[model samples]
Target: MKPSYPLMLTALFGLFALTGCGVVAPGLAAAPPTPVPKTHHSAAKQKPRTPSPVTVPRPTSGNELGVVPILEYHMIGPTEGRWQRTPQGLYQDLTWLYDHGFALVTMQQYESGDMNLPAGKHPAVLTFDDGDYSQFEWNSAHVPLPTSAVGVLEAFQKAHPDFPVTATFYLNNHPFGVDSVAKMQWLVAHGFELGNHTYTHADMSSLDASGIEKEIGEEQAYIEQSVPGYVPVSFALPYGGLPQDPTDRTAVLNGSYQGISWHFLGVALVGANPAPSPYSKTFSVSIPRIQVVDPSLVASSTRYYILSGYEAQFLQDPSMLYTSDGSPKWISFPQNLSAQLNPAYSSRANPEQ
Candidate 1:
C-alpha cells in the first residue's frame, strides 16, 4: 500500500509541536480566555454527612486509602524538557480527569475534613513547581495567553465546565517569571493558591536548622508582603529534600521566624507515586508527587506509573480508591486496607472482624 504522506506528516507535526517546536495551526485564532470568577477563598462546598437510605457496599480488596493522586509538574511549555508537559498533554490530562469524574481540589482542601465534590466524584490535586514563566504570563492584550499553563487550564475548564479551575502553585523568589506581586495576588483573587518552594529553591537536607529556617522564612515573607492575608498552608520541598534531624520536620510543619509564623498541613515530595488520603496513617511529611512528563523522558517503569496504575481501578472499582460519601468525619476504604488508614479517621467498625 502507498504511504499516507499527508496523515504521516500531520502526526509528525503534532508530535513536534508538543515539544515546543513553535508550530501554530494555520488560520486559527484562539478565543479570549474566560474571566475567572472572584469566589471567596473559603467558599468550598461542604455537605453534612447524613445516613444514606441505601447502604454503600464495602470493597473486599482494592484502593482503600481514599488515595487522592497529587500530580506535580515543573514546566508547561515543552514535552522534551525533564518534568515538563506540553500544552496538548495538559489538555489531555484535564480531559481524562473530567471524563473519569476526577474533581480538582487544593492541597488545603485535601488536608481538611470538608470535601464537597459532586456525588461519586474522586478528588485530585494539580500542583506546579518552580513557577515557570510559561505557567502564567500576560500577553500584549493584557489577557492570559491561551498557550500558558493557566491559560490552558482556563480553556480546559471552559470546555469541560464542571472541572474545577483550582490549582496550587509552589513558588520560588522569581514567581512565574512575571510581576510577582500581581501574579501572586491574581492567583489568590482567582481561587488559585500560592505555596512556598523556598526563597532560592534551596535543598533542605543540606541546610542546617538556621539555614532551613531562613530559606522557608524568606519565601514566606515575600509571599506575605506580596499578598497580604494570604497565609500559605502548603509547602513543596525544594529538590524534594528533607532535613536530617527529626525535629526539622516539626519546623517545616510549624515554625516562626522574624515574627512571622509559618505552617503547612501538606508538604510535597519531588517525585514518586500518588499520595494516600491525608487521613491515611501512611500519609506524612513525605507526600509523593507524580511528575508530569512525556513517557520517553523517564524510565519505562516510572512513566505515568501512578495514573496508569490507579486509573482503571478508579473508573471500574472506584471504591478501591479514596472517595467521599458526603462524610469527612470518617475514613472510607476497603476492609483489607483498614490497617493503613489513620486510626483517628477510620470508621468505628473493626474491619479485621
Candidate 2:
C-alpha cells in the first residue's frame, strides 16, 4: 500500500532509472517529494567559449559506469515472520558477497566520503532497517541459536580479511537493554554502525506541521540516548512515503545525512539491479540499492555492478556533476571534452580529396 522511491523516479522515460531488467520488487512506500524554495543565480557577462558535453558512461570492465551497488535488508532469522529472513538465507547471501569481492563499508566510512573504486574491491553496503531482536539472536541464543548477525559478519570478515565489511541498523526508542548494548558494542567495535529508524517507524507524511517536528525531535532524542555516539543523518521513509519530508524541516535538521536516496533496491526473492548501471542512475528520492540473498544472485549482481570499473574516473573528477535534480554541471575532469576533432566538419568542400 506504501509508495516506493522507485515510484518517485521518473527517468527521461527509462533513459535513466534503469536498475537491471528483472522481476518487479515489493512496495516500500509511495509519493514524491514536494519542491522546496530556491534562489536564482545572478547573471554575469563573461568571455565566450565552447561548452562541453555531458557524459553517459559506457559499460566496460573497471568502471563502465561510476557507481557502487549497495544492498538493504530487514530481518535475518529463520522465522520469515514479518520482514525477516532466515539465518540460513543470510549465510547464503553473505558467503556470496565474500566470494564475489564486495568489500563491506561502514556508515563512518560513508560519512568520511570519497567512495572510490578501490583496486580489486567491490564496495557495497549491507543495511538492515528496524533493529529487530533477530540481530542479537543469531549468536546469542545458545540452546538452538543460530549465528547472530555479528557471528556471521565475524566469520565472513575472518575468511576474507582483505574485504572490509560493515552494516547499519536503525534502532527504535527502546533501550538497547543491558545485554543488547553489549552485543551492539561488539558489533560497533568490529565495524558495524547504528542509526535512527525514526522513534517507532512513525509515518512522516501523515502527521501535521507541529506533529512532524515532534516525531523527529522525540525520536532523535531517544535514538541518541538509546545508542551512544549514534547520530543519525539519514531517514528511511516509514512505509516509504515522500509527502512528509518537504513539508517539514525538522526532519532534515535531525536527519542531516549527506546521501539520502532509496528505490526498488531489490529483494532477496528476486534481483532487478544489474552492474554497470546499478548505482549509476541517480534520483534524489529513491537511490537504487541491491538486495543480497541468493549465492548466484550475489555473484551475478557483482559482475553487473560497475563499482570497481568507472568509479575511479568519477572520483578523480566527476564531470557534469550536479545535485540530485539535473541542473547545471559545475565540475568536470580532464578539463571537459578532449579527444580528436571531427575533421570532416572543417573540410566539407574537400570531400576526402
Candidate 3:
C-alpha cells in the first residue's frame, strides 16, 4: 500500500526532531536548536555517481566559454500564471530551444562544466521548483499522465533522441503532494535529479544562523533518508532569499545541523538572465536563472520577448552562448577570448584560432 501524506510527514517530523532540530513553520521564527552528532547513517557522504559518457559529432569551431541559460520553472498546468507554464507553452519552448540548437542538460552537468554536446550546440538547464503534483503525476495504470511535465519531456525525447530528457527538480516538503519514496526513486532511476528547496520553503533572508542550518540541514536529511546514496549537489534558495549575514550566507553554501551536514557545489537564485559559463571566470556557486513565464505577465526581461527576453538576446548573438566543443576531454574557445576562461580549468583549456 502507498504511504499517505500525513504519515510521511509524521515520519519526517519525527526524524527532524531526532536530529536535534525543530519543525519550522513557514514565515514563523523558531528557537535555535542545539547541535547534536548525526547518528543516522547517510550515503550523502559518499562520492556522487558520475554520469554516463555521451557521444556526439566533433565540432570544428565553437565557443565553450559562453553563457548558458538556466531556465527556472514552477507549475506545469493548463493555464499559465506568474509561476506556471502551460503544457502547450512548455512543448513550444522545447521545440523552440531544440530548433535554436539548444540541448537539454542537468544543472549538475552545467555547474561542473561537463556538458558534452554536438558541435555548435548550446546547453540549456531546465529546473522545476516547488515539486507540484501538476509537474508529475501517474495515471491509474501507474504511467505518467500525458499532459504532465515528465510525460511531455519523455515524449519530446522520444521524438528527438538527441535532446535527452534530463532536468533537476528542487523539492520542498510533501513533494508532488505524495512524499512517496517510490516517486523519488523513479526520478533518480531515470535521468532526473532531486535538489533541496528547504524543508518548509522558509525565506533564508529572515532566518538566523541556526534557522538557516535547520531549514537546509533538515531537507538534506530527508532527501538522504528518502533516496539512499543520492545527495543533492545543488541548493535552490527558497523565494530566492539570500541570507543577509555573510556567515549565514556561508552556512547556506555549507552548513551542519545536529551532525547532518550539507555541502552544495552550486546555489541557484530566483530570477534574471543566463548564467556565465562554468569555464568562465565570472562563474561562481551563486548561479542566476531566467524565469520561464508568459511574456505578457512580465514587461521586460520576460520569456518570449524579442527585445528583452534572454532567448532573443541569445538568438541575436549566438556567439555569446556556450557552444560545446563536442568533447569533455577539452574545453575549447577562441584564443582571442581566452582571457575570460577561469584559470582552474586551465589544464583542460583548448583555445582555437
Candidate 4:
C-alpha cells in the first residue's frame, strides 16, 4: 500500500528537526489523525479493492461545488517548442472527447443561476493560459494542420454549438503581441470568457500585496484599455503558481474573476479533476493547474481529464468515500450548485493510501 502523504510529510519534518537536535524529542511519539474518508463518493462499499475513483470528497454545499470540466490549454500549435500542440492533433483530441460521453461547457454554464448539472455530473470549462497569438490564428489561417488552438476550438464549436463550449484565454501582457486582442474581445462578446494572465507573467507570490495586485491587476487593465471594455476576470497564476492564503489575487475588468485555472492549463492534465485540483487544494492559496506538455500526451489522455473533476472532490472529502467494487467512486452533490468542503481546505499535501 502507498504511504500516506501526511505521514511522509511528518516523517520528513521529524527528520529535519532531529538533524538539528541530534536526538528524538519527548512527546513526539503521537501521530496526527488520519484524514476522514470522503463518504459521498466511491465505486464500492467498504472493502479492499483497487484505487480507481479519485478520492475527491463531495462538497458539503452542492451549490458551491458544481460539476463541470475546466479544461486548461496553452500554445496549441504545430511548433514543438515545449508548449505548442498541432492543429490536427488538437482536432482529433476534441473530436474524440465530443464523440464520447463528454460535453464541452462554458464557465457561464457553471454559474448556479444559469444551468444546473445532472446528478453525479458537472460541465467542464475549457481554458488557455499565456494568451499565445497562435490561439486566434486557428480561425483565420488554413495551415496544413489545424495551425492553432483557436482553429480546432472553432471546429469543435461549430460541430457542437449548443454543447455550451467556450474557451478562456489567460492573456500574457509581454511575450505575446496584440493583434489577437480584438479577436479575443470578439470571442468574449459571443459568450466566450476572457481572463487575466498577468501583465508581465511575474510571480504574484513574490510581491507584496500591493505589488501583487499591480502585477495581476495591471495586465487586466491593459487588456481592457487595448480593446474597449475587454476584461478577463478569471485568473491563471503566472508560471502556474499563486499567492498566499486568503489572498485576493484577482483583477476583474469586464466581470468578476473569483474562479481560477490550474497551471499551464494543458489538455492532458484535465481529467475531470475534482476540486482541490492536483495543483493545490488549500482553497485560498491553491492555484489550480493542468500542464499542456504536448499534442501526443493530449491525444492519449481524455478519460483522466473527465474523471479528474470527480476525483478532485474525492481527494478532498474527509469521508473516505469508496465503492464496493470501486469503479466510479465520485462524491455526489446536487446538480448546478457548488458546495464547500468540510475540515477546511488543506494547504499542505495529503497522500492517499
Candidate 5:
C-alpha cells in the first residue's frame, strides 16, 4: 500500500477532526426521526352560559294611595326650645328617614307630581321654617358651619353616599343670616328650595288682603331680585295662620306687587298632619305639615301622629301604598285594598276570557 505522505497526513487529520467535533462524514446517511404517539379526542363539549334573570319586586295590584309625610323643622342649632332642633337631632332625623327607605323630595316635586321613586322607595319632604341663621350658616371664612342644618346634611350625605341631599327652606325677610342674598343664591345653586314665609313673618291670618300682599309680594320681589333666576312656587303660612275669607285666600293664591306676582302651588299650614297625596283634591291649597318640634310638644299636640300612625305603616307594607309602575301608570296595591282607594287611582282590570 503505497500512499503519498502529505495527502495521507491531511486525510487522517480531517477524519480525526470530524470525529473529535462530533460531525458526520459527508458520505454517511442521517438518523431516522422518532415517531409521535397520537392523542385521544373527547366526545363531550362545554355547555353555553345562561344569563341571570332580572330581579324585580312582585307585582302588586289595587288603588291604595300612599301617604307622603312632610316633616317640618324650625331652627337648626343648640337652642333649647320646642320650635328648634339641634344639629345632632337633625342628623338623627335624616338618618332615620334614610334608613327607612324614604327618599327626600322637595315640595315642588310633591306638587308637580314628580314622585317617581325607584322601586321599594317612599318619598318624604323636609322643610325648615323661618330660614333661621342656625338652619344654614357660614363661618367668617364663608364656609358652612358644622352646627348648621345644611352642614349636617352635607356631612351626612358624604358619609352615607346614597342618601338624597335636599330640603326646602321657608324664608321670611332674612335668608341664611348675613349676606342673605348670597345665601339665597347658594341655596338655589346647591339644589335647595326657597319658599315664602311672608316678608315680616307676621300672623298672616290677622292681615288684610292688602297687608298679605305687602308681606308676601315684597318678599317675593326681594327673592326674585336677589337670586336672579329663582321664583318661589311654594309658600308656608306665617305662624300657621290662614286667611279665612275666600277673597283673602284668592289674593294670597295669585297676588301681584311691584310688577312681581306669586302663583303659589302648594300652601303649607302650621298644623301637624301628613300632607295628602298631590292627587287628592284638597292637596293643592291646604297641604298640612308634620311639625318636628319638642318631644313635649308632640305629647301636647299630635304633630308626629300622622307619620307615626299611617305613613310609617305604608312604608312597612308596599301593598298599602300607591306608586306608579312604568307604563300606563299602574298604581300598585293589594287587590283586597281596592275598596280603600279611589277608583281613579286603580290600575286597569282585565276581565275573564
Candidate 6:
C-alpha cells in the first residue's frame, strides 16, 4: 500500500519539531518556474564516447568488506513528502552525511571497485530516480536554479570541497521533464552518471521478455545517442519491479534492443538497506538501495529512515560500514572478515590483523 503524502509531511514536521534543519513550513518560497524547453529525440547515431580515466588515490585504513549506503531518492520539491525531499532537506541531508565522515562516489565507481577515500572516510552513492523537473532545472539565464537538486549539490561541494560532487541520476524518457540532448550531455560532462531507468518506467514484473528489451534498450539508445558515445553502465529497476521469470530477469542484466545491446555492471533495487561491498563474496549485480525517506513518514512495514535507521546502525558499529582502504589497487579489511572477500578479488585482498 502506498503511504499518504500529507501524512508523511505531518510526520516529518513532528519528527523534527520544526527544527531549523531545512524543513520549511508548507508554501515556503521557491524560485519561480521557468519555461521548460522542448526535448529533442534525434535519430542520428554517433560513435559511443568514452569517459576520461580517473586516478585512484593510495589506500587508506578501513574495512573494504563493509556495507555501502546507496541512497535512493525521487522528487526534490518545496514540500517534503513521500518519495520527495525539499531543497533545504537535500542540503541538510548532505550536511548530515558529510559530518558523519561520508563522501560522495558515483554508482560506477562503487561497482567497479574504484572507491578510494581518505583514512576513516566512507563512501556513499547518491541516486536520484525518475528525473523530475525539480531534480534539475535551468533558469532563463541558462543556469541551474538554486533550489534544484543539482544546484544544491554543486553548492554543497563548493562549500565543502573535500566532499566531492558525484552522483548517479537514473533517468527515464524525457529525463528531468526535458528531452534536450544538451542537458544529457551536461550531466555526463560534469562527472555525473546517467543510469538507465527504462524508457517508460514500466513495471517489469508484468512485462514479457520483448517488453523488457524495448523498455531497457530504447532508453539506452536514447542516452547513447543524446551523449554521442556515452553508454550507461548501471540500471535502476523502475518501480523496483523485476521480471518474474528467471530468464526474463537475466535479460535485464544483459540484453539488446534493435541491435543496441547493453550490459549493466550493477542493477539497483528499491530495497531499504545498505548494499554489500563490491569485493564481498555476497556481492552480485543486484544491488540494494536505502530510500532516503524519514522513518516517521513511512509505515512500520516500510521503515527506511536514513538518519534514524541505517545511519544509526553505522554509527553504532562503524565496522559494518565500508571504510575505504584509500588505495584502489588493494582490497583491505580485518583478517576476521577474510572469509567474506570475493575470490575474484583475492589477488588484491589485504586482510590485516
Best by lDDT: 6
* Per-model TM-score versus the true fold: 0.76, 0.55, 0.81, 0.53, 0.73, 0.82
Q: List, residue by residue over 1-353, the lDDT tens digit for candidate 4.
A: 11134423432343234334533222211112123234545645557667686555533332223323445555655554334556775665566456533445443333211333343233345677676666665223433124656667766677777555566676667423445656665676766766666677665446555666566556666776666865443555554333443233322111222232222112111112333321111222222233333434333433233323334443475232211111122333333212233233233212222
Residue-level lDDT of model 6, residues 163-232, one tens digit each, is: 8888899988887666457778888889999999998877787898899999999999999989998999
Per-residue alpha-carbon lDDT of candidate 1 for residues 31-115, written as tens digits (9 for 90 to 100): 1111123476554565656656635544332233677777777677654455467889888888888887778888777765355
RMSD in order of candidates: 13.0, 12.7, 11.0, 15.2, 37.9, 11.8
Residue 285 deviation, candidate 1, in Å? 2.7
Please tell me which predicted candidate would have the highest TM-score against the true structure: 6
- Report lDDT (Cα) of residue 40, candidate 5: 46
lDDT of 2 at 235: 51
Model 5, runs deviating above 4 Å: 1-64, 296-353
The reply for model 3, stretches above 4 Å from the true place, is 1-60, 300-308
Go through the candidates in order and give the clash count of each: 4, 21, 0, 70, 1, 10
Candidate 2 residue 92 Cα shift, in angstroms, is: 1.6
List residue ranges in candidate 2 displaced over 4 A: 1-65, 79-82, 107-112, 138-145, 175-178, 253-286, 292-353
- Tens-place lDDT digits, model 5, residues 1-353: 11134323432343234324533222111112111223444522445467566444334432214567788777776754456788887887788788777788898877665656765666788998777778888887767888999899889888988876889988888666688988888888888899988887766668788888888998898889889978998887765556655567666767997688988776776545556555433334556666565555343334234334444555567544434442223345444544544344433331112
TM-score, structure 6 vs. true: 0.82
Q: For model 5, where is the 10-residue window of minimal lDDT?
A: 26-35
The residue-by-residue lDDT of candidate 3 on 1-353, one tens digit each, is 12234433432332233223322222212212111223645766777788666454334588998988888777888887666788888888899898998888888878776677877799998899878888788876657777888888888888998778789999887787664577788899998989998988877889989999999888888888898999887888776666777666778877899888887768787655578788787677777677777778654422332213777677788899999877876788988889998787787778885
Model 4 CA lDDT for position 345: 29
Give candidate 3's root-mean-square deviation (CA, Å).
11.0
User: Which scores better on lDDT, 1 or 3?
Assistant: 3
Looking at model 3, the pairs that clash are none
lDDT agreement with native, every candidate: 0.67, 0.42, 0.74, 0.43, 0.65, 0.76
